[model samples]
Target: MTANASVFVEKLRSVVGDKGLVTDARARHPYLTDWRENYLGTALAVVRPATTEEVAAVVKVCAAEKVAIVPQGGNTGFMGGATPDESGREIVLSLARMSRILEVDTIGYSMTVEAGVVLKTIQEEAAAHDRLFPLSLAAEGSCTIGGNLSTNAGGVQVLHYGNARQLVLGLEVVTPAGDIWNGLRALKKDNTGYDLRDLYLGAEGTLGIITKAVLKLWPKAKDVATSWIAVPTPDAAVELLSGAHAASEDNVTSCELMSRQGIDLVLKHLPGAADPLTDRHDWYVLLEWSSTRARREAGNEGGLTEKMEGYLGEAMEKGLVLDAAIAQNEAQARAFWALRENHSEAQKREGPSLKHDISVAVSRIPSFMREGLAAMKKVLPEGRPVPFGHVGDGNLHFNCQAPAGWDKARFMKHGDAISRAVYDLVVSYGGSISAEHGIGRLKVDELAHYRSKIELDVMRTLKRALDPQNIMNPGKIVRV
Candidate 1:
């Protein structure tokens, strides 16, 4: 190590104590690579801070030494936003030790938590208090709230509760210069000035480190009804969603789409997986509706399950749905959701594939899927498309799998061209090349190419103003 780097590590170790600093290569391996193993980086050291004050102190030392800092949470992010670069000069600031639930205000319907708290812990705590924290994802068991806020994560419930950004009411951030911005207000009417909280919420740690957050909560649902429906085409699924909303008074909590190829992969790779419907269809949708009212009271108003059944019956009568199966109980509902959540894992077992997390307007999802699939096929006729995700929110994980008997490496050689073809179509439809996942390192160039001059300039200006030294998560979001 360089003389300056040695001195910087000593200072960081002093602030975090012996247990907080990890310098052994083997111990640091997990933090260096991304979840998908797509990005592998080296860092000077990994530091864990237990409190907001400790985080600020660590940042102060790093800033003084002019060292770049990469604030990492659960490290379950799809993009390489939290991984350090190859230089081995950046410090990996891990928040695992800072996990804590500082406060929970049931009356205000909000909770304040330290950044390191696991998302599932928050959800459980909220439920214990008879409230609900609706921000959920496949990795909620390990992913932290800080990472969710940094990436602006969206999951199955985004159709009802909104993304991580909408669920957060305030934040306590440690600026790049080692100053704390205590904007952790629980007020819902804070229109006082420039909304700094929103700026940092999805900045991917480029501007500052989110140490804590005040998150919004809702009443726990008393009844939840889940259904798996088969549609002849993507357009029919879209039409069915419209009819469901109209019939259920917008109570649709989750609406996910799955292609026949995706389902086949799940059934083949995931043990205990079963086909939810009797007949096979080209496309399918898994949807649910929830109500917080008591079951007896809810039943008096025909209940959420009855309403969902009525909606599906109407959709089937109109030919929007070809077949349907509604879960009879909670166990069955969970079984239906297991198929949707196991998609990523099942695809991993199948083979290496190129994944794209992109979105378009909800109304244009059908057209985007149709056109995007054709564009991708033209690039690689042998590639199989596994297009599925939250159709109600228009975000699709449009992934491409290698054809049978083809080598994974050889198939991946065409990944760039296939991605370009699909992304170009996304741009043509006035859609986002990235939906829930932030830009990180993977989409930096694409963001530069697609974003307008004015938009890029404004982003750069903000980065420079907040982090003049560029010591906080450099080379992320914007290249300022």
Candidate 2:
């Protein structure tokens, strides 16, 4: 290490103590690479701060020496948003040690937690109080609230509860200049000017580091109905979603679409995974409806389950749904959901693939999927397209697998071209290139190519104003 880096490391060690600082290459490997293993980076040192005050102190030392800080949480992001570069000049500021669920206000319907707390922990804490923290994701077991807020994570429940940003009431952030901005207010209304909480929520840690947050919660649902339905095409799935919303009075908690191939992979790769429907169809939808009213109070008054069944029966009669199977109990519901949750893992077993996380208007999803698939096929005819995800919200994981019998390396050679074609179609449909995942280094160039000049200019202005030295997670979101 250079003299300056050595001095910075010494100061960081002093702030976090020897136990919190990791300099060994092997020890830092896990934090430096992303969950997908697509991004590999090297850092000067991995520093774990046990408290917000320690975090600020570490940042202060790093800022004084003009060193880059890559703020990391559970490190489960598909994008390399939390990963450092290979320059060895950056320090990984991990929040794993600062995890603490500080407050749970049952009456207020809110919870306060430190940044490092796992998403599942928050959910369980809320549940113990008969409240629900509805930000559910596949990585909930390992992903941190700080990372969720940084990326504004959207999961299956977003159809009803909205994304992570919408669930948050306030945040406590450590600015790039090593100053603390305490805005952790749990009030429902404070139409303050500029809304600084939002400015940092989806900034992907480029502007500042989120140290803690006040998150919104809801009453636990007493009635939940999950079902796997078969649809003839994407158009039918869209119609079914609309019809279900009308029937349930907007109580539809989740609506996920799966291609035939997506399900086949799950059954093939995931042991004991079964097909929910008797007959196979070109497309499928795993939808759920939930109600908070007690079953006794909802007796014979058309609860969520009755509403869901009535809607599905009507849909089947109208030919919108080809077949349907509703879960009889909690175990059955979980089993049905396992099929959807295993999509990414099952696809991994197939081979190397190019994945696109894009979104369009709900009404335009059918067209987007049709056009996107055709565009990708035209570029690489032998490629297999697996388009599936939260179709209720218009976000589809448009992933393409290598043609069978071809080596992984040869298939990856066409990844760039396939992605360009798919993204171009997404743009044509007025869709975002990145739906849930933030634009880390993975899609930095695509963001530049697609975003308008004024948008890019505004982003750069904010970056320069907030992190003038470009030391806070640089080379992400916007290039400064």
Candidate 3:
């Protein structure tokens, strides 16, 4: 430990008090490691500040001591964004104790929530008031609202409602220098310059810490329809998505593509998961459409299930879909969603894998899958490339599960080489490398390689301008 280490700890404890300060190594284990267990880091201590002002004070002390503050929420980020470094030079500022639902204005169609509020809790609170909070993710049960906003997380609902950044109206951030930037408002239309809210949305805490946010909400989707369709290939899945979109126009909410391999993995690895169709197909899509109860009462055309049935029939005739099963009630609807949401967990049980969250143009999704999967197999002969995700939004998980009975370490050795090959192809098709997960420590190099020089320069400039000291979440996002 440094000569001044004890003094630093004493100051931090003074800021957050003894109850909020955690210094034991065992107690800090959960905060030091990421959700995927890919990155195991060490921290001087894990400090929990219960309010935004307390967070600011803690950050201010750390900045003065020239110590790094790793802003963590839920520790549920997959890319190691919330995890600290192995050097043990940083302090983990956990927002877990800042769990407060500040306000829920149904009339304004928005809610102001503290950063540590569990995502599922916010959803339930919204539901209680007859409103919907649509920033849903697989980790909704454990991930905090702050972490979701930091990563700008995308889930199955992203095809219908946008990602976390789009759902947020404003943010309250603690700058690196310890000043709190308060921009919390429920304004739908703000013609402000630069849209500063976006800067913090996906910054991964490089510029500042997100303490609270004003998130947009929607009227509860009462009349809803869900379907699981079997398709011949990714090409066929694309056709089905287009057909459904054409049928529902604006009402089409969720469109997710699932590979047969992905579904099989889910059923085999995850309990209570089942195939909705009797016969297996190469690919499948779970789609949903929704409308408010008031809208449903106005006309028969508003019935999403009937409209989807007609669309499916047309798609079958056109050879776009082989067969499909539309959920008849809420119970079946939940079951269908379970199959899609259980993908990551199921894949984990299969083996350690190289996961990519990349996106291309919607029209190019099929081609990207065809070419990308082929390229990956060529590099590693025994690789099982499972490409599936939000086909409607053109984002594919494009993960490669290790071949059966292969050495886990040896297979993982080629992770970078394989990532390079896949990312190169994505760029050729004008796609993004880090689609939903931010460019945390994991993808920093990938971002440098795939991002244009001009874009990198702009990002660096922004980071430098906002965080001149570079004390906020060091070694994340931009290299600065």
Which digits, one per residue and each the tens of the lDDT, describe model 2 over residues 22-134?
87778889999987778899898899999999999988998888889999999988889999999988989999998999999999999999999999999999999999999
- What tens digits encode model 1's per-residue C-alpha lDDT throughout 273-358? 89988778899999898878765783346577888888888788888889989999888988888888888888778887888999
Question: Which residue pairs in model 3 clash with each other?
Answer: none
For each candidate in turn, the TM-score is 0.97, 0.97, 0.97
Q: How would the candidate models be sorted by lDDT, starting from the highest? A: 2, 1, 3
lDDT of the candidates, in the order given = 0.90, 0.91, 0.87
Residue pairs in steric clash, candidate 2? none
**Which ranges of candidate 3 are over 4 A from the true structure?**
1-3, 294-298
lDDT of 3 by residue, 302-397 (tens): 487888888899889998889999999999999998888888888788888888999999889988888998899889978888888888788889
Displacement of residue 439 (Cα, Å) in model 1 is: 0.5
What is the lDDT for 440 in model 1?
Answer: 92
Worst 10 residues of 1 by lDDT: 293-302
RMSD of 3: 1.5
Best by lDDT: 2
Per-residue error for 160 in candidate 2, Å, reads 1.3
